[model samples]
Target: MREHRGVPPILTVVAILVLGLTLSATAPAAVAAPTGKPGDVVRSTEITDRPEARMASAARVFDVTYLSADPRGRLVEVKGSVSLPKKAPGPGGWRILAWNHSTMGLGDSCTITDSLGKDKRGSRDKWLGQWLRDDYVIAATEYQGIGGPGVHAYLDGPVAGKNTLDMVRAARTVVKKYVGTDTSNAFVSFGGSQGGHASMWSNSLAKSYAPELKNAATIAHSVPTGLSDYFAAIRPGFPNVVVPDYVTYFSYVLAGLKVSRPDIDVDSYLTPLGRTVIKNAQRLCYAESGPATKGLTVGQLVSRPLADGPLLPALRQYTRLPTSGYGAPILLQQGYLDVVAFTPLTGQFVSRLRSNGVNVTYRTYPTQLHGLSTAQTLEAVKWANTRTTWPR
Candidate 1:
């Protein structure tokens, strides 16, 4: 196996990183304490660089480490910033607002801009900070690969869930400095695009994965996931959307599949184009993803049915809804104007959840595109405050 480098040694850095910190030493590794659920723990920490000056406006932002319960042992470190107002939300305790960033590291990458702020939009929009400031403790994550080591898991389900869930736990454990509350207070999650998918996975798994969480809220704006649905949607016409970038998603799925089914050959699934995309995806940015997507067509990539191989079966488990509904209330915000995630698909999924007897609140926003919907974003935060007392 070729050495896929980039992941930092998280376990090695935990002790030196958390020293003199508010959190006590990590309870123990791979062993769940009698806290709440299967993978619950007292707390954990990580070493990350200090935030840039722009981040200071938010009460405090810190880099922290957390564990990946995935059998793959992927690194799940992230950078999170939190602002706790004078009063916490629910029961006069602490309430947390965890923003799973679109593509940037957990910090508000949306805030960066040129002089006129012409290109300040997209995933880096700064509205997140302003929107979240007075409400609760806002924590954004960078996921596993952005700052630390190994390739970023991207939209890979288990890997994304691992980082998202761990970051939630780590944020609650560390944010006591700004907002004093037990890890159990009101905890809400929100993200759009890939972020929305992350929120859904986190909310779904919180019951079994991190039972300490009280409320799990998800706001999805044009979630470009569901590999099967995505592959099917972009086929025949939108070649560039599916072919060039479809492989980008496939690579993560391949790596994730490698952990469980080693026999599956990742290279076999890739064409000459697919291999090049994976090798260069790290260096490519938002600007590049657009131009790179040009000229490619979906028909070119769907040469054969992806279901013929093990990858499709693996992806089924990856994109499927959660096994059991969340113990906490769930709020799903979808943008009707979103072309990426598409309104039809999101609507279908929401209807299915309702049929399955899930406790859910669905809000659809018109005029909102494939990014964060203001209605959904505000609702998730307000819901979070009501659910927990962490910020109080």
Candidate 2:
């Protein structure tokens, strides 16, 4: 109207009104998320980047966003990758592996997409490459918050479990869409470190959370358990002895609590110095952040005692792994000398699993350290294959 400088002629005005209504009714709307059920794909974009798409055995790779729920049962979107094998499947269809990743960090830049891309390729993509070569559909979740909504719930077991299982569902959908092949209902949960922790939760939650998908077996290595006990040692000046990456690991827990437990006032639990450290921790990935924690100690970072009282309960909820509720057999691999996941804590976790009558197969490497268990992956995959519940 201002540009026109006067009311248009009646015919012109009528034409303008008609065009406005037509455009309003016909113009494409902005992209909207799919109505999600747990595991339903919200969207999947092909990974065309050379480094990211160059999987040795992948027919196609995608960066997928799918639905999952927080601990509070609220729906949320989680990002993950779906790698379909180039090789044709046997009559049994594609064997599926839900690969839970180890700790990367609470930052988006540390997501599987980033790790699968050119920035940093660790043993993670290499392991997935093996699965792809062996003719498996691999669904590796980056977890709920790494590149999705909200801050990551670092060690939040149930949440990670949901994301991992849901990724399997999304993988099946993608495999069918892109490959025109059916998938075996049976799938295995496999991961190391934080991924191990997540796989354990997926194993326990599968029967209850995703009855439609058959969780054949689960293999976890160097998983964190009995975290409550370790957390109890964190006081203003505690741990009796400071250890490498303790501050880095604990600060990650705090960073996650910023979103997962808003009532906790996570910042209040920190000292002024602690607050500054946590802000950086939330943004930096493991490789970048781990070195920064060199010489940093719990005593220097925190002012409050997390061992007892109000904070203790939340810590237990966030860190403690479930010992029972496992419907399928579990293979737990541990390294006696592993510093990343202390041996004693894993022992306690295994004991609880057995005491609860859970069918658990335990393997320990006396000479192995945390990541050295990679050599045993072939054996672990064999074990999972034997136990896999296949369709008749």
Candidate 3:
């Protein structure tokens, strides 16, 4: 109902991007860590902290470390959490409800799991608990960075999708190998803000990437689509304050590309200030990243227009959400007043999906709806429940 642009607007719009997210580079292999399959449990330990336990409610909670791959298919360790039901599953067995978080930051210090114990994360805990009460296994990925290695590929839906699906894979293994329980292969990807963007790619890639798992539905709320368009929206010497602080997302997108798409030579497109800002962005959390980039417009961030460089093509290929190829039902929750994701762009995305024969259910909210909307959450849950592939 309110708008907050001081933070995450890209994955969170990067608008109050709001989620404690991070994607990183290779986890220091020098540091001793467990080893296993991509989805196998590298580590799984239950949370015993009083506050964190309260979040678990009746569900069993486990902090887990697992492996995922980058766009280049390089092995990367990703951190996530899994919550299991205390009671038995329904006749169809336990289904997976994977949570792809919004952007928090892109550094080791900004890890979401580590911050989960804080008092501020209560709502997220509640959200996870709701899924637990629904009798679903909850898998929340901290993306590819933080507890493991690699940068949290900000706004890179393909990488986000890979991390999300792999987290589901890791969750399945954590529940089975550690708790001695097996979950069904069915799942639904749910996310808001940056996570919303991630959910779309996670579900879209399910058929091709995680073919073993069946995605019944995908819920993307306040998702940033048509990323290429967004990249092009900003021009140099543009009036200040014309855009909200979310303009910092340009630094994030470029910071991510600096590592993920090194071929683009991200530095080549940026001025000295741009490179320095991006370098700082790579290590700073979302909150800090914004302030660090204060007063800088998108135009100031780059030496030339994005269209003048190879960045646009890379952004289109790596970041943009596709409208077609959704095998499962898709739900899009948009806020009319959300300048971050822009309702008009989302409308176009919805139209493309429907035109492509995707089962699309698009809803509108009056505000940005960055944080959880009880009405929205319950409705999305209900919609997802009706669409899950329980029989499969």
Give the whole-model CA lDDT for all candidates, comma-separated.
0.53, 0.80, 0.75
- TM-scores of the candidates are 0.69, 0.86, 0.85
Clashes of each: 27, 0, 26
What's the lDDT of the predicted structure labeled candidate 1?
0.53
- Give lDDT tens digits, candidate 3, residues 1-392: 12456664455556232332322243333555445556766777787454543354445677888788765676677788876776786656678888877778888877765344465646655655677778888788888766567666687777888888988998888777766667888899998888998899988899999999988899988887777876775556645554455656777777877677878877776777777888888789878877787777767766667777677888788777887888888888987877677888889989988999999989998764444477678888888877665754
lDDT of 1 by residue, 1-392 (tens): 36646657885478567773534555544533223432232343322223332232244444454445433563333333334333344555444666676654211232211111133343222445533355455556565555544455456555666566666666666755434655345456777766777777777767666665655455445565455655434322333443224443444444445444556565455555655554455545544544664555434444355555676766566555563475556677767776666778777777777888877777777877666655455566566556534423
Residues 343-364, model 2: lDDT tens digits: 9888888999999999999999
Point out where model 1 deviates above 4 Å. Answer: 1-57, 70-93, 104-127, 130-132, 177-184, 232-263, 298-303, 373-376, 383-392
Where model 3 places Cα greater than 4 Å from the true spot, the runs are: 1-36, 53-58, 90-92, 114-117, 241-244, 369-372
Query: Which regions of candidate 2 deviate over 4 angstroms?
Result: 1-34, 113-126, 239-242
Following a full C-alpha superposition, what root-mean-square deviation does model 3 have from the true structure? 10.8
RMSD of 1: 10.2
- Maximum-lDDT candidate: 2
Candidate order by lDDT, decreasing, is: 2, 3, 1
